[model samples]
Each structure stands twice: as C-alpha cells, then as structure tokens.
Target chain A: MNYLFDLNAFLPGVIAGVAGLIALLIDSYKNDHDGIYGLTVVSLIAALGLSIIDMFGPVGEAWSGMITYGGVSAFGNTVVLLGALFCVLISREYLKAIEHEFGEVYAMVLIATSGMLALASANNLIMIFVGLETMSICLYVLAGLIKEHKIGAEAALKYFLLGAFSTGFLLYGMALLYGATGSLSIPEIAQNASSNLLFIAGAGLLLVGFFFKVSAVPFHMWTPDVYQGTPTTLTAYMATASKSATFVALILIVSKMLPAETAEWSEVLEVIAIITMILGNIIALVQDNIKRMLAYSSIAHAGYLLVGLAAGTPEGYSAVLFYLLAYTIMNVGAFGIVAYYERQQGLDFTDVNNYAGLGFKRPIMGVMLSIFLFSLAGIPPLVGFFGKYLVFAAAINADMIALAVIGVLASAASVYYYLRPMVYMYFREPHKDVPFVQAGITFKGTLIVLTILTIYFGVAFGGLHDLLASYYSGDWVTHLTGN
Target chain B: MISIDWYLALSAILFCIGIVGVLIRKNAIVIFMCVELMLNAVNLSLVSFSSHYGNVDGQILVFFSLAIAAAEAVVGLAIIIAIFRNNFSVDITQINLLRW
Candidate 1:
C-alpha cells in the first residue's frame, strides 16, 4: 500500500502503455504505419529484455512479495515474451493483409503480456483478479477487432460472455475461500486448511472456476468456436501465450492450496482429463479446416497437461511446463504458416484439401507444417513427443497407471487426425491454380527460427530438462502448505 | 439479530439461484446477470467473514471486486452488441456456430 516509487516494478508497464498510446496516435494520423509497427515491436523487445534481466540478473529483493522473479516466474515470463515476439514477428504481414493495420493491436498485446507477468508473480488474490481482467479486456477487443467479419464478431461476443462467466466463478470462489478462512492471500489460504463445510464448498467451486479458465472438459465448450472465429494470428496468441499463463496460474493454485489434500480434487480432475482427451482427439478427426483441427488438438493437449497435474508431484508440474514450452513452438509455427498462406491467397481459410500438393508448390511452408503435425501426433524425435512423454512418465511415476494408459491411447488416436492433412499435402495431386505464395522476409525468418527451436528442443531434451530441473526445483507448496 | 448462519444460508441460496439461471436461461444477458448475482453472493459472504474476523482486508477486497465486476459488465455488454449484430438475436441456443 506504500506509495514509494520503485521505477523498476512500474517501468515495463509504463513503457508498454506509452508505446500503445503512441500507436493509437499514429493510427489516428493514418500515416507512418510501418514506423508505428516498428515502435510496437521495439517496445515489446525492451520489455522482454527487462523480463530476462529480472530472471537472470539480480533485481533487489524489495519487490519480492509484489512481483517475485525466481526461476518459475522467470520461466513463465520467458515463454510469454516469446509469444509476444511471435505476435510482433507475425504482425507486419498479418495486420497488413487485413488493410486496417493499427499500432494499438501490438501495444495492447504487449500490455497484456505485462499483466500476465504480474499475474504469474501475484502473491495475493486481489492482484491475480486485477491481472486476469486486464488481460481479458484486451483480448475481447482483439478477438472482435475484425469489424467486417461476422465470424469475428460472433467469436468475440461468445468469448466475452463465457470469459466473464468464468471470471465470476473465479471471484466467487476466492470470496468464499476468504469467508471460510478469514484471509485472501494465497499463502494464507494454503496454510489454513479448515475442513469446515464452507471451506470445502469454496474449494469445490474454485476448482470448477479454474477448470473453466484452463478450458478443461465439461467447461471447454467455448474454445473451438472462439478459436475458429477470431483472426488466425489472434488464435495463435490464445493457443500459446494465454493458455500458458492460465495454466501457470492454475498450477500455482493447485500445488499451493491442494497438495496434501489432493485426494479431494484428483478424482474429479481425472475424469475431466479422460473425457477431454478422448473428445478432443475424436472431434478433431472430422475437421477439414486446419485452424479448427488445431483448436481441437490444443484441447487434447490440455487434457495431456492435466494428466501431469493430476499426478501432483514436482516432476509432474515441471513436465507440464516442458510440454507447454514445446506446444508453443510447434503450434505457433503451424499457425504462422497458415497466416503466411492467407496473406498470399488474398484472404482464404487454409483447408486440408487446399494443402494437397502444397509440398511441391511451397516446400518450406509445407515441410514446416508437417514437422509441427508430426510433433503434435507425438512422433519420436519431435518436440511434441517429448512433451507427451514427460507427462506420461510423470503419470506413471505418480502411480496413476490407468490415467497414463488412457493418455497413451488418446495420443495414439490423435495420430490419425494430425496426420490427415499431411496425407493431403504430400500424397495427393497438387492443386495447380493456387500456387503457394512467397513469404515476406520477416515471416520466413520467424518461421525458420521457430522450426529450428522446435526440432532442437525435441532432440536435446536431457540438457533442457536438466537446466529446468535445477532452475525450477523450489516448490511453492512446502512453504505455503505448512502451517 | 441475524446469526452468522443466516447470512451464510442466504448467500448459499443466492448462489444456487445464479447457478439455476445459468443452466436454464437462454438469453446471454440474463445469464450474465446471473453471474453477477453469484459474485454478489460471494461478496456478501466475504463481508460477513470480515466482520467475524474483525479485519477489513476482506472488506477492501469486496471493493476491488466491485470495480472489476463493473468493468467486466461493460465489456460483456459491448461484446453482446457485436454478437447481436452478427446473429440478430441474444439467444444462446441460436448461436450454435459449432455443429458436428
């Protein structure tokens, strides 16, 4: 509550806000659009630089309670910054194609990234809700930003309604927990494990709210529609950055408050994981549109992450983090290629049939997408395989044999759908009229970097895991859960 | 004088009403109203707890939540306007863009 100025804690947000305001001004002028875009990108890079410094460099311990910067928060921040960069990398081309380019888009994205940074470091419930709303409000507008498209409008509205509903649930749960325990701080709630009926009710409702936020089954009905309706670039942003942040918040909640008492929640979560995996993979099999297919694929991946979570161990938690990191690379690359083609084709959905003979026409885009698909299917020596492997291994180690078995079956079933587009792309006759468009330099450069990272992580798992293990060994629960 | 249990029971009933509204109402706006109701129910309980513990932290939180709820409502309405333009109706049942 002190009004003392520490420029460090407030600097990133201020920079992002100023950059966003400048972008809005430039867009209003309707000139120097490229300059505006450049400014936005530079702002995000600056923020990314600060986050890395906070992670690796020694920031004074003054703001530890407000915004801690140890290994786990640093890891989450690094992934989120990567997402922002990917958005910035794709912005010049994607925004240019829509012909209504504005700097506000990039600015808002960076600001949201900052909010997520705070959310990850939130030591209390109040900061968490503030962070959640700041992030969500920007996204609602971003989702519906394409004014000309009815689909965009529909997606935005649906997302807003459902997101607000979930927020309500989340807030109510927080309040009830406060009521039951007479505390609102997460550390306080975690330690005071009163088994009163009110406490149990609050916990139960809070689980539902978190499940909705992560888009777990029984509460995930909104994901596919929203994903399909939003712009492809925005969809990629949601699939990677937003999902990563939410899961980080979710894992913190579960581990900090419900570790020893996991038996109360694990039973319900196990059922959710099983249904989410099966339904997501099965529905994806019938999708002809590549984006929609990826939407379902992301859902199935969520279920796989849940399998790690259900195990409730450090190995399980780190395994989820590793998998999310891998998913970010593969999914972003996949969507990047789609965004590339949409620009060239003068605005068209990337359907599976359209990709037939694409391998011959646009070898680079086609091959990159194939790698992403294979990885998603959990093929060996790909990033996706290791992500799923870690989660499954964690599951077995936790002795959740049946859940691990079902997870494997779900991944196997996923192969059929993930590979379907590859079949159309590589094996079938080429579609002659729609030649693959030459990607702009920025787009191509980003794709190459993403592809390399995807493969490198897939192959060199031991080192990355070891580094992550050493860096991320401290458990928030031991301190929070003990009275 | 109303006992603490009375306040708790009243909050529970309000929460249940919100749940029923979400399950039964087809109008997106109405469903949103129900969500607000649920949040209020939680706030009522929080206020009661603040009194019980003789601390104002929980009460201060209720204010913060109220601000957030107001913002959420504004955004929700804006989105509904966009959707109403797209579908020409506010009925959730009619907005099924995802059909197998």
Candidate 2:
C-alpha cells in the first residue's frame, strides 16, 4: 500500500471543523447567538450533503489508507451526520428554554460530530484512537455544559473518569496488536493474524473497550448516570449518534479485520448479546426515572444490534446498518420528548409518575411520545419493529435458533417497561397539569420529521432494504475486491 | 542489553499499575492522572515497536496519542473544576447526585 494524503475522504470532517470554527469566530462579535446557530445548522446540512454525494461516487482511499470511503463506512458517516442534524434541531429550543443557549453548544456539537465522522470511516487503529478521543472529550464538556446543575457536573466527572479508563484499555489493546502484527492498518493486520495467545488477548481487550463505549452489559456502569446527568438534548445526541458511531467502528473491525477469528468472536458476541438484552430490560423495569429507563432500553437495543453482528454474514451486516438507521430516528424522537417535558416541568422532573394523565392534559406530547415509545417497544407499523424483524431474521438465517428465541423473549419482557410511561400518561388520573412549551418551530419540526420517518420506514421498510442491497453490490463489494 | 521484550515488559507493568490506580483511586484528579499514565505506557510500547521494526508509523502514532492525551487532560480537568465548583470537592463519593 502506498501512502498518499487524499483530501476527498476528509471533506466531511473538514467541513464540520470549518463550521465549528466559523461559529466560534462569529460568536464573539455577533452579540446574539442567532447568527452562530444559523451558521452551525447550515454547515451541518452542507456536511450531510457531502456524505450523500460521496455515497454515489466511486470508493476511494485517503490519507494512505488511514480512512476508507464509499462503503459501509460512508453510509455509516451519513447516518451519524443525519442523527446529529436531528439533535441540533431539537437542541436549539431546549437550550434556549434552559438559558444555556450559547455558541459553545453549537461548536462543541459540530466538533464532536466531525470526530464521529472520522471514527466511522477510520481505516487504521491509530486513526480510531484519535477519533475516539476527539469525540469523547467534546462529549465530556457537552455533558457538563450546564455547570450550574450539580447533577450535570457530577455526571461529567464520572463519565470522564470511566470513559478515559476504558480508552486506556483500548490504547493498550492497539499497542499489543501492533506488537503482535507489526502493522496498524486493518487489512494488513487481518492478513498477518498469527493465532498467538498475545493476539487473542489483544483482541479480547479491544472488545472490552468497544463494549464499554457501546454500553454493553457488565461494562455499562456509567451509561445510566451519564445519560441522566447530561442535559436532555445532549443526552439525546449521545444516546443515538455517538452510540451508533461506536458500533459502526466495532462492526467494521469485527467484519473486516477478524474474519479469521469469527468463530471466537461470535461466541463472545452471542453471550454478551443475550445477557445485555435480558439484563437491560430486566433492570429497566425497576427504574422510576424516564431518562434512566430509556438508558437501559438503549442498552437492550444495543443488544438487538449485536445479534445482527453475531450473525457474522453479509445479511447480518446490512441488518445492523438498517437497524441503526431505524433506531436513530426513534431514539432521538424519544429523547426529544423527554427533554421537552423536562424543560416544561423542571430539570429534575424525571419521575414517570409525574406523567400521570399527561396524555389528556397535553395531547400532543402524549401522542408523540407514545409513538416513540411504541416504536421503541418494537410494535407493528413502526421502524423499530422492522429493525427488530431484520435482526431476528438474520440470527435465524445463521441457524442461531437459540439466539433468536432469546431475543424474542427479551423483547417480550421489554414491553412492560416501555409501556410504563404510556400507562402513567393515559390510564392514571391527572396529578398535575402537564403543560409543555410549544413555541419553538425547531422543536416541533424535529418531532414532525422524526414521526414521519418512524412510520415511513415502518411501512415502506422494503425500499430501504432494497437500497441497502444495491449499495452492498455497488460500492462495498467493489471496495472489498479492490482491497 | 535491553531487548524489545524488556521494554514491552516494563511498559506492561506500568500499564497494569495505571489500570489499578484508575480502579482503586477515589480522588477524581488522581484517577484522571492514572488514565494519562496508561496512555503513556502505550506510547512507550509503541515507541519500542517502532524502533524494533524500523518503521515510522508507530512513532507517528505516538505523537498523535500524545496530543490526544493532552487534549483529554484539558477536558478532564475542566470537568473536574466544574464539579468542584458545584460541590466544593472532587471526591467521587461526594459527587453522587445521580442514581437509578
């Protein structure tokens, strides 16, 4: 492989950084944050356009194979950017309501997004480390951006400590991998697998790090606190886009670099997937706080995504992509509603009981949130159902009958907790007036678009699956052959 | 007469100590420092590998990791200060405002 610095592969990330810098430079003199906010959104849309355009172009190598384009990585970046776009949409109003509407939010979000874009397409282990750190540091600051809140401050500290520790494990794993293989590129490392205990241990440690980032079982201690501690809008962004990017990087490595040891990884993924699903759902059942509940639900959803990974087939890979697309929309919408409610009542108004008779009092919030909840529960005629269906099908296709059965049982158990909010919203008598702020066009637009997408993908799921198939044949397959 | 294995072994030991510090330490800043220690150990190992293989990639990667570690420390300290402002302490136990 030759080393050449190609700018095309870095275009999306570059544009994002440029946008962030523009926001910061203008923010100091603009007096009001309106200009900064407008510029930030415009640049985000521009980056989104670049990602879409790159999808159709021929796959290319950039930075001497440190990053790849026009395949799963490209599609993954597109999804991450779109998720960030929705986050910005909902965030504009939430920040304003909380009196934290500053240029830093826009700049930090863009910086974190560029990092995610880098991580999504990274081709080398070194690039992955840099990307992860860039994304995580921004997230730590974003989580604690509301410094006046004790919980926000506390949450940031815990997340910073735990996240850095996990990153240590990741760096050590990369070092061991380099020691074992004498290379940093995924393709080169794959070709040089030595089947030594050292290599196995390195890979295992790497999985531990990845699992921590994606909030898998046993390594998920910080997730609930971090999710509940961050301001609702930032939490929404973290739970969806950041988690998806981490999984994309994980899937890329598991599929691209570890095909030689798929058997070894499949066993590990299978066990973790089952435990993650069961434990996440079971624990969610006991949480009274809505944010905490959704945190565990997000973990369970990660488990379902892992089932697609454990299948270890092309079909499974596409299923993971499709599930991520569906899951992002629904999760963002769910968290948007949480933020809206938290803003209306108080920052600490997170108890499910507070939502009693909320459906009758505030029909719009109730209906929209119910739609998100039902989608999360994997109910029919919603994107989450289709996402779950595809992953379960992939598991069964791989002859993993037990895994599929367990996935089904876990989904069944999850319905209770998922409906807990709905029960308080509709079935119970009104405890207090559940008036919500409904003035921001950005907030309303985000809900409207996400609701349409949730139902649109749910009903016309075939269109996406077909498009994914074409993409698989057109770009990813060619890139693999070229490699 | 130190071979590459000696460097690897020494780095590995330092890495383990860092991990223990992160797990066992209660002071937020100390744990944060331990994380930096772990990252430095990795840098040491990477440098050793680069020299043994006579490739510039690992050395280049060490530079990237060093920069990232510094960036991380800046962010970590900022967050610790924010926590300290809110609670007047950086002890992990004292910062427990979120539980589920």
Candidate 3:
C-alpha cells in the first residue's frame, strides 16, 4: 500500500488550491482586486497548459489509486479550466458594473476550480465525494455573493438545500455499493460488479445523485431558479465547468463501475434521456428571461449528452467527451454575452424583449450572441451542430437509432427558442434605451477567442474527436486494474 | 449478537424519515436538520458494515462524511441567516423571487 506522490497527477488541482489560499491572504492584507484577478488568470492558464500536456501523456493511476492522470482526466481538467478561465475573465467587469466587486470572488472561483479538477480525476469514491462537496460548498457561497439581494439569497439557499439533500442519497448509495462489493475503488467495484439487487439499488441511487447534479429532468427544478438568480458570469461557471466535471465522472462510473453485461441500466438511461430532451426543450421554449432560457437549454444539453452515455459504447463515450468540450466553449460564450448585457442599468435587462435593436447598437456582441445561440441550437457549420452530430452518430452506431431520431427532433424544435433572442436583437426596433456599457478589452478578447473556437471546431472537429476517441480504446481498464 | 439486517433496517427507516421530512418541512432550518439526519443514517449503516466486514474504510468514510456535513451546516446556516435577514422569514415558500 505504498502511496505515490506523483506531482504531475495532482499539479493542476494543487496549483489552483494554493493560488486560492494566496488570493485569500492577499484579499485580507492588500485587498487588491487586480492583483487577485491576475493571480487567478495566471494559475488557471498554467493548470490549463499542464492538463493539455497530460492529455497527450500516459494514462494511469496515482496517489495510491485515489485518482488518475492523463487521458480522460486530463481532457476533463482542460475543459473545466477553460470554462473557469473564461468565467473569471468576464466576471470582473460584470461584478464591477453591479458594484459588487470583491476579492473573495476570485478566491472562491479558484477553490471551486480546484474542486472540479479533483472531481474530474478522482478514481476513488472518497475523492469524488470530497471533491464534490468542496465544489458544492464554494458554489453555495458564491451564489449568495450579493447577500443583500433577495433573489441571490433565495438562489443560494435553494442550491445549498438541494445540493446537501442529494449528497445524502449519493453517500448512502456509496455505502450500499461498498457493502455489496466490499470495495470503494471504482475499477475494483467494476471487477466485483454483479446484477444482485443490492448492487442494482446502489447503482440506481448513484445515478440519481449524478442526474441531480447534472440537472437532468425530474431532478432539475433547482436549475433555472439558481441560474437566474446567481450573477450571470458565475452562472456560466456553474453551467459549464461544474457540469463538465460531473459528466466526466459519470462517464467513468458508467464505463468502469456499472456492470457491462446488463442492458437494464442503459435502457433506464435511454428513457431518462428521451424524457429529459423533450421536457427540457419544451419548457425552454416559453421562458422570456434570457438567463432562465439558458438554464433550461443547459438541461436540454445534458439530455443530449446522456444519449451518448445511454448508447453504452466506447464511441458513445468519446462523443460525450467531445460534446462536453464543445458545450463548455459555447455555453461560456453565451453566458459571457448575457453578463455583458446584464451590466447595463435596467431592471428588465435580462428580458428578451429588451434586446430589441441591440444588434445595431453593439454589432460585435450582437453577432457573437447570435453565433453562440445558433451553436446552442445545433445549427450547421458550428461546433454545436458537430457535437450533436457525433453524439447521434454514436447512438446510431450503437443501434439506438430511435434515440438519435428523437434527439434530432427535439434539437430541431429547440431552434425556435434559441433564435427568439436573436430575433429580438436583430429584427425588431428598439423599444427601451438601455445604455451600453463599454466592455473591457480582456472580456472582448475572450469572447473573440470563444467565437473563433465555435466556428473553428465546427469545421475542424475531426482531429479533436479522434483524440478523445482514442482515450477509450480499451487499454485504460488494464491500467486501472494495475495489470 | 444481533444480525446486520436489524441495523440496516433501522438505518433505512431513519433515512426515509429524513427524506420525508425534507419534502414535507417548510422551515429551512428543519429541512437542513433533516438532511443531516439522512447523512447520519448513512453513517450508522457505514459503521455497521465496517464492523461486519472488519475493515476501516466505512468508518473512515463516516468521518469524512461528518466533516463534510459540518462544512455544509456552516454554509447552509449562513445562507439561511442571510435569507432570514432579507425576508424576515426562513420559510421556503415565501422565498420565491425567482420562480418560473
């Protein structure tokens, strides 16, 4: 039981963690906002680089098998770090505009990023639980950052209560699985996996916990409220980075721990996916508030990712990973623009009708917003469409053609809502004058990078898709078992 | 000399009570307490299983769960206080500013 202190395996999380502590120290002593911001950006970029390096490096366990490095974990870390980087870049402007700029925000973001990194690479249930709690607690506080605001308070309270409630189910599920299989290590659990009733129940509860965190339907009631009430930029972090981390962990659970021989789990996931896709898209169609609309859209996106998981093939899993990267890029872009709009002084700034003629006022933001929305709708020649294409193609390859068709139809129906705000922005005449705030250079530059990524990945997604697909080519299981 | 089933059944009942309380309770504090009860119920089961299996993993997990629960309680209580200050109530039904 020798423990390995593999620095590369833990470097990304450790960098973020140490930076968070230092940011807090600086906040208390110097209270320099720019200093904290610079620190966050530097550490996140360094970690992002390391994670990319890990993506190309070897894949194996570290720290006595508490976590894995390289390959899938590295890929997941890259997405999470990318999401956090964009969110932090955009947050300073938005927070200052709202007159709530504080040093603690940077610390919390870094700490949460650290937690997400841990969750992404976790090989043991203990690591997963600790990482999740670490992330969830910071998020609960961040949601209520504007403590004086009533909606922010409500959002934080709801998120905390529901998050804690879900943890109980998750822990109980872990306890049961450990009892049934006599192990907590994911690969070992898979080795001893069976179709017994106890194992099935534990797995079901585990799925429930994962489904709740990912905001799947029937467990998604908290999403819109929380997303709408939290500060727009932080909501982007929650929507993209946190969801990517959880989905990656879920992929590991489904591929490694769940019994492969049984079709029952995949069947259950398929039903949930269909329901999630239809219900999420239908509900999103009616939301007038832009933030609420994106909230429902995120749930719908989760449904599409679940389709890949339900396919239960390596191809399906790889598609899920690729879709996660595409999703992180476009969602952060959408929310970035939303935060930009939110900074303008108007009570109804988030209302879709208020966006009329905004396309004429700020041509760049208007166009970027349109691109993000179009990508979200899975339109052709955009990354979002390719993401949908890969997931559905994987489903079809796995003989789940009906699931793929339903997914296509649901996304097609979704085109209406995604376009509604674009219509307001471009087609309609200005009704109310919401003064335009000048966005910082960094914010604009980040959006430009994201916009480029959306179009570039749309056209040239093949190589990235192939790289992700190679991670799951079956040898990693042997690495996990230490063979 | 008691069988493990008795302990498991008791733990299950406690867990169900916590779930029901969370669903039915209106007070945020009460709901938070219910969530803690659920965690403790799981802790109890973990302890029983640890003894049954002669391994310390379940007990170690219980300790971690306790620490996590404590952290959650601190944050949850702070949030509850913030909400209370804003609205003068911890009743979840009254906190519907962002409803769809």
lDDT of 3 at A11: 95
> Which candidate wins on lDDT?
3
For candidate 1, what is the TM-score?
0.92
Order candidates by lDDT, high to low: 3, 2, 1
How well does each candidate superpose onto the true structure, as a TM-score?
0.92, 0.96, 0.98
* Higher-ranked by lDDT: 1 or 2: 2
Output DockQ, candidate 1.
0.60
Ranked by DockQ, the better of candidates 1 and 2 is 2
**Candidate 2 lDDT by residue in tens digits, B61-80:** 89998898888888888888
Model 1 iRMS (Å) reads 1.9
In model 2, what is the error at residue A322, expressed in angstroms? Answer: 0.6
In model 1, what are the clashing residue pairs, if there are any? Answer: none
Give lDDT tens digits, candidate 2, residues A328-427.
9999999998888888754246889888887887788789999999999999999999999999999999999999999999999999999999998899
DockQ, structure candidate 2 = 0.85
Stretches of candidate 1 exceeding 4 Å from the true structure: A1-18, A21-32, A57-64, A346-348, A471-483
Where does candidate 3 clash, by residue pair?
A: none
Ranking by TM-score: 3, 2, 1
lDDT (Cα, 0-100) at A59 in candidate 3: 90
Error of 3 at A66 (Å): 0.7
lDDT of every predicted structure (CA atoms): 0.78, 0.87, 0.92
Best by DockQ: 3
